[model samples]
Target: MSNEIINIIADRPFNEAVQDKYFERVEAQLTEVFARPRLRSFAKSGGVLAGRAAETIDASVVGPSLVVFEERLSEDDKQDALDSQAFAEAVVNKLPAETSQEQRYMAYNEALSAIGWVTESYTYKKYDSKKLTLTMNDALLQVLETVISAGSGNVLSLVAAGFDKLKGDKEALKIVDAGSKESSVVSFKAVPCIVAPGGGMAMVMGGLDVFSKDYDGDFLFFTFKTEGVHLFQAAGIRKFNKRAFDRKRQQVYNYIDQFGDGLFKKIAG
Candidate 1:
């Protein structure tokens, strides 16, 4: 099934008919998955809170394709959703209409690589504040240590000063204390940092209270009332794109899982 779809997309002047067929195949697969009795029961019981289970499944299946689809949209068009046919057309529509075929091919390959990363490594989990503290502390310590090892003495001093301030700030202390006591709950999402060409991975920790200086890489942005953390890696920085956020956010309640401790250890060590 996958090979057939790949072959269809490999042709130059990408065929809309073939793309439609690909979407149909994906839709069919999702439909079957959602039809399972257990999933249906869960969905009916409000286990899937962000709209219907079908929509969640749709988003997860088509999410990767949007990486390619969105790159072609104009500012105005980006505000609207594109149908499968329209998306197919956009895939072949190189901006400026004069882009060389070689450049177009390179863009196509990059999109393919990005999509592969998401499909293969994206994950979701739910954790209590105690667990979250351990995870966040490890990640923060690693980042700080990395900077120190690089001999960025001035930056290290600045970051250490910031950390000291965070420890004293009443609001910051409240969150840290709450998380340390396991009184808070959190939803976590991790995916390959596709937006950043060389980034290892990006994480979003919903309900986790963190100071600005707590993170050292790229940048960290915040959102209010968001169901899950949305981190979109593009160019050299990570940003929030709610529309492309997790479709599996609701499933977090069903699982108690550890974040990428091994990955962190490997990088930190």
Candidate 2:
């Protein structure tokens, strides 16, 4: 899936815009759901089910076995997670296990818990192939977006291209963190695309962020989310007729190039 984050900053009071209500409701709902004991427990299990794949290939071995780790979201004695409860009830009704409802629920819950993990942050480094790589998942970007949205200031998304991910040089961090500079081949732009009567647009476009780094074995490529700087309504052109299709699409690609270059300069410099 394309990794991107679109931020919306309304010129007028939020109450006057569609997303004002949507985000307000969602923020409230998230606050409530996130605070619930059951939901908190689920969140501790990485917010949702996840998986990983890393297998060794050998001619001698008939097949490769994947090492997988999964976490189970537990229900609080007094509170229940909507999704977890539904999943448990469905498994129980199917009679998959020859056990009581409670036992079945527990068993299925435990079983699914073994699927994988949801992470607040994670890092991947591999050096066996022609390229070395380091990548961060959407969860991390989401947090960054939250920080950016809550504040009213200039936020810079830096990309480090053609660098060493495994480098231990202490100064490397400072170099990448330097203030912004001008760029010709690359730039970053944010565009507002969708606006709803009540809800924020479902989709938004962001300037692409790109970076390349060196790993243990080879070169690594990194892509980060840079959704348009502002958020808008997400109505479709065919039905809702919000904006010109050509205009929106062009804005997206241009911003992507600009942002991509901005980040690239930081890394390459």
Best by lDDT: 1
TM-score of each: 0.20, 0.17
* Model 2, span 13-90: residue lDDT tens: 212234333234324434443232222211123222212112111001000000011112112210112222222223
For model 1, residues 1-269, the per-residue Cα lDDT tens digits are 11111111222333345435544533443444333333221123332222442321111111111111112223222211112112222333323455533343334333332222122221111222212223432333333332122543433343333334443444433322332232122211111111222423321111122322333221112223222322111111122222222222222112101110111100100
Report the error of model 2 at residue 247, Å.
Answer: 9.5
Q: Using TM-score as the measure, which candidate wins?
A: 1
**What is the C-alpha local distance difference test score of each model?**
0.25, 0.22
